[model samples]
Target: MDQPPVPPAPTEQGEPVALSPPLLHAMLEASHCGLVLLDDMARVIYWNPWVVRTSGVALEEARGRRLGEIFPESAGGRLHQAVEESLITGLPAILSPRLNPHPLPLRAYAPDGRGERLFTLMMIKALPVEGGARRTMIQILDISNSVARERQLREQARELRAQAEAIGRLADHDNLTGLANRRLLSELFFKARSRAKRSGRPLAALYLDLDHFKPINDLFGHRIGDLMLVEMAERMKACLRGSDCVARIGGDEFVVLLESLHHEEDAVIGAQKLREAVGAVCRIEGKTLQVGVSIGVALYPRDGEELEMLLRQADAAMYRVKQSGKNGVALTTREEGGWPPFG
Candidate 1:
């Protein structure tokens, strides 16, 4: 058994009175927190039952041993420095878990009940006393549970943020083809128009309607129609520039936005490329399939300023192509790129 610490306390008359060592020993033995007493040389003089249970070192073994000898990992840490400062200056110091976590090799069961080895989070305090051979006392509090809860909350917050981003993407994208929906296309149109105004460049919208699509959809099932639509969207995407955006507005109808255009002729070339991509042969569900597209190109400041007006003019031009023949492209402006009034 180790001896009790008799620290001095001042009476009302300013006289130093020593606390009862036996009673102090009993109290320290029942304490929930770890309590250690060190002599003038910073060697352990008293090791309470709490310290014995937590550190797994018997009182007789801890007696007359330096803290560094008991836990070599704490030799150069803040806990060691605090003990030295308290013994020398008779002042108190605290090592918070935030700055000096796991200064001592204290073990505890993981909060998640996994039976894994977990380093106990500790808040250590070194205080100087005034009596007996014990000059300093070290107190350690277990804060592992609180730290674990804080980490769990941060992890939950990150998961919630990721879920929110995924939801936002779902809202803006078409469910079947994974292309921009009409709502997102409308929103992006305004932003692209803003860029066109700032850069003094032309913007174009290509309204495309697949020719003879309903006959195929009627012959095959809707599943095949859906798969064919996905294939066509992918081919259109592959042919367009990175800055351009393609959207499936509805069944057999799509729209392409040409955002960066140095010349209006780029819109014509892009429309031709899209017609070729849509008109290619594809094998869907082990059956050979082919399709044609009538694309109507509309340019900014020539067709109309608003997206709705541009799409309307492009739709009219596409109707003209359907009347003439399928698998062809048309422009809202005259054939010579001359300005035409909006009807």
Candidate 2:
């Protein structure tokens, strides 16, 4: 019968403890990460059970084989370069996931329970041994879970940004006509007014009210009325230049802002074009419908300096058009006097 193995002698306090070869081998076998040891000749000498499990290679078969023979795919890769550097210069090397994502072909079961093989995200370390024999120890840590979490966080950030943009659009635009809402219009007015003040150029604000619109709503239901409103908004936008803005401030009440005008007559021309475009016949839902507009023009610094003052004067002028028959345009004249009847 064989005798029991002797235990390692205990060291003094704060000193290193000696472990027997069998205990060291046992610890290595139970390690959680991969460990591969190569001799000076670059031949596989020892490897932990973790390496065996991940690489799917038996210990007996890989004991004396070269790394190139064991993992052919890693022969011309970063791992091979790192191993060569460590063996020649006796310097340590680290291969991070960012630089070398899949340096090795080590496999693991996917987390989805499908028993599919997934190439692991590994952080590899090659350390040169400073012992009696020249050797290199390679350590591999699986970082698949961490990498997956980082990817998920990036995707979530993009999704959140998209949602925020959608919410911003909803807040700044009218839902029915997709025109600039009050909030956006106020901001636009501020910018336009500032530019007009600096350049001494005139800015025109045309306040428009659709005539015969209420009759359509009363005769037909609100559905057809809504379609008409949308159609009218499109027509008004088409009649203006890209630099101009048209906003539906209220039901049947729209405001057009024309910037960088060459002359005061430009406002009248724009107003007439809008009047014609809006007064055109619309066949919405097979119903022949026609409407007219009463437009009131207000000039910057001439009518009023502020946006509210200009809008108010323009609205007042529009009301004057409404009182005098209908389907006509009126320009807010100087404080001393006003323009005659015009369309």
Instruction: Please write out the lDDT profile of model 1 over residues 86-125, one tens digit for every residue.
Output: 7666667777776776777765544543432333444334
lDDT of 2 by residue, 282-315 (tens): 8998899999999999988677677788888898
In model 1, the worst 10-residue window by lDDT is: 115-124
Distance from true location, Cα of 155 in model 1, Å? 2.6
- Would you list the C-alpha lDDT of every candidate in the order shown? 0.82, 0.82
**TM-score of each model, paired residue for residue:** 0.80, 0.82
Residue 207 lDDT in candidate 2? 93
lDDT leader: 2
Model 1 residue 294 CA deviation (Å) reads 1.6
